[model samples]
Target: MLVTPLTKLLGIRVPVVQGGMQWVGLPPLVAAVSNGGGLGILTALTQPNPEALRQAIRETHKLTSKPFGVNITLLPTINPPDYEGYARAAIEEGVRIFETAGNSPGKLIRYFKQNGCIVIHKCTTIRHAKSAIRLGVDVVSVDGFECAGHPGEEDIGGLVLLARAAQELNIPYIASGGVADGRGLAAVLALGAAGANMGTRFMCTVEAPIHQNIKEKIVASNEQDTVHIFRTLHNTARVFKNKVSTEVVAIERKPGGAKFEDVRELVSGARGKQVYETGDPDYGIWSAGVSVGLIKDIPTCEELLARMEKEAEDVIDGLVKVRVEKAKL
Candidate 1:
């Protein structure tokens, strides 16, 4: 297979990027992904402070010399104490890739670029992708409606969004959302994407820090097991079907339904942190994409990569045979 711009830019053998999922994208998981020939991402906020992030980076380096990235979600709730300090620390740690989400980094993008980091901002819409490209980001991860963790209100799928981005921008982009296996990877490549960014799929990996209960739940799920909630607040998120999510949807459907603030309290970030770490599903919110249903087992990152490559090659070979038969006919 031909290497895409994403592989070239990230200096990875495979174009797959393990999404910077909170609680999940830690040093162990990140190192596993990178060692498996894919780009592993460390969630910057997973650490308590910049020094912690730097320490985690060092640890990941010790595990694998492969290239990796860091994700820093630009959200309002983040403590404003040392956001820039964290960025600087990551740069000093020799982290070359930075992934931003939630809001535009704007000037922060420039600062990272100045420090020799290749920025790849995640956006759910074409407009946002354009803005990132204009800001001189090396690449963009176009997250579609199927993605977890705040998949914008536009509800655009990767197919339409990637086409739009490819037509409008000259920069390379990877398709995120609804991507789980090699078939999904090949599909995105067919849709004009260079590669795919995966979150839920990586969560099912053995290296992920989530509890076994959570991993098992993902393996048993299907496409219909996901639902989008909090649309009223303009912060729609695709999550697994759980007691909390069911309640959120039930409330949303009721006449004169509860206010966003009310539900917001029920699904607080602190609560989510606990559920994700402890596997107490009913305790709080758990952000997951519909792709969770497609995941079947908790394979190691290396195993997953090998399977994906084999499957992708087989799929491509089958397609080539079909074309040859059609020509003969």
Candidate 2:
């Protein structure tokens, strides 16, 4: 019943698109979100390599026939994976929705457009969003400072950020950062967003392939449960606050300790993957949005999306009643 530009663009019933959480965006979770009537995005880099990503796509296809996407974050690294090879693999698997983030998506944008794919480039600043619009992206997933993963250095919250996006840009955007529940969905729609992109909240779902201990940890957390690491390096990331992350932050505060090598072990992605596999919440750098505090139960993707949709409708209906009626003046 709730429709928006995002829903139509993505050909999904709900305007919700699961944020592709790294190491956690597995096939089971992606397929569940798709089967639940929303677009699910697989994390391309989560696979070992391009060939592994192709196999992951094939695995997802076996679970559900619904449309899904792949998240290809084009960030710079010492040895970057072949981003183009991953895109080609996704295309070969019939994936038309592409979520591109990090670095400039210029080359990837052109390739996706040429292939008639809908590319949603996530950006933290309005300038980048405008640049992406000019660069031929289909939609912009506006990530505010409250988001998990790379929240950019701007540190602007979603409330102000979404308004800025609505004011300055012509393209439709989905609100990210701190968005988790039906009220958040309703709030974003009122603030002129097409929809929302959620990360932490989805991690607390049954479909999420992470350990149950991790899911419960997210559920037990509140807004204060997240801490920002990598700020010392100026490539800030929001992660679940824990012994490891806390230690990382403490080290960053020490004199001459802001270098990457100083806290590399605590924030290593390799260690983070072990945390996911072993269900140790304090093992390594694990990302979570402030919305983690809002998660109270671990529901299935279908149950969560269905309830969120109903709640959004209820809120929107309430808003519709706020119109002016004839009054004696």
Candidate 3:
């Protein structure tokens, strides 16, 4: 088995992590990933309230005894959900791992650490990763420009981003973006990431809990099938290239550019949730990473992870052979 700091830290057998996706990170998917030897995460805000999140946690416990996590995204909202209450709910329910994203994790970090939780903060830039480290995050999930959802303002892809993180950061980190296969996993490992955190890839799994049509849409799409919306508002989000998303981009590029208010309805969470339930690919703006180009089939989490492990091993072995041959000259 390929062991890394991430595996050791999370007590997982593989270095694959299913990233927390809104609407998609439910119990089935999360439990499947954890049972398949990767760390799975539920999106806390996906629950309607702290009580709802607590119930979700309890339900997940019924599904798998393996390690899983909850993602608590802290964003600047007019009426924010009770972030502390959600944290308390997770802690009370015996969740030992957490994935925090959006805004500064300063306030939440202290409580999570105090509870003996292993915090993995997602960052779009090395600077932000450094700040998270100072806040006592145990690990960093470095997101690249190729990631879905909010990839921050920086446009660095995993190539330069992961390498830069390896050069500067002292703690263990995982690569989050454009990772779909064993080759991608091996590449990230070579670039100094302890593992690869995949959102788009996991979305195509059998237990993803989304409509089959959506999974088929992802399989049929190439890397270029994605577009970035809300770039003008400076909270650029990478989403699938569909009618709704295309229109959102057009509206953003209008005369004086646009604000969040202008495109709010188009990118509403409700609409995105409908796309998954109704199986309509173009019904709304849905997040997807460039890794969509690499997904060819919707395999079970067990099947996918097994294949990835073999593929990563083969790739590493091939690299070693190449180096040995070159050294003989």
Residue-level error in angstroms, candidate 2, position 307:
0.4
Please give the lDDT score at residue 162 for candidate 3. Answer: 97
Q: List the residue pairs that clash in candidate 3.
A: none
Where does candidate 1 stray beyond 4 Å?
A: 78-81, 325-329
Tens-digit lDDT track of model 3 for 1-329? 89999999999999998999999999999999999999999999988899998999898999999999999999888898899999999999999999999996899999999999999999999999999999999999999999999898879988999999999999999999999999999999999999999999999999998999999999999989999987888888999999999999999889998888888888898999999999999889899999999999999998999999999999999998876444564
TM-score of each: 0.95, 0.98, 0.98
For candidate 3, give the lDDT of residue 97.
97
lDDT of 1 at 198: 96
Clash number for every model? 2, 0, 0
Q: Which window of 10 residues has the lowest lDDT sum in candidate 3?
A: 320-329
Q: Per-residue CA lDDT of candidate 2, range 151-226, in tens?
A: 8998999999999998998989999988888889999988889999998888889989888899888877888999
Q: Which structure is stronger by lDDT: 1 or 3?
A: 3
Task: Output the better candidate (1/3) by TM-score.
Answer: 3
State model 2's lDDT.
0.91
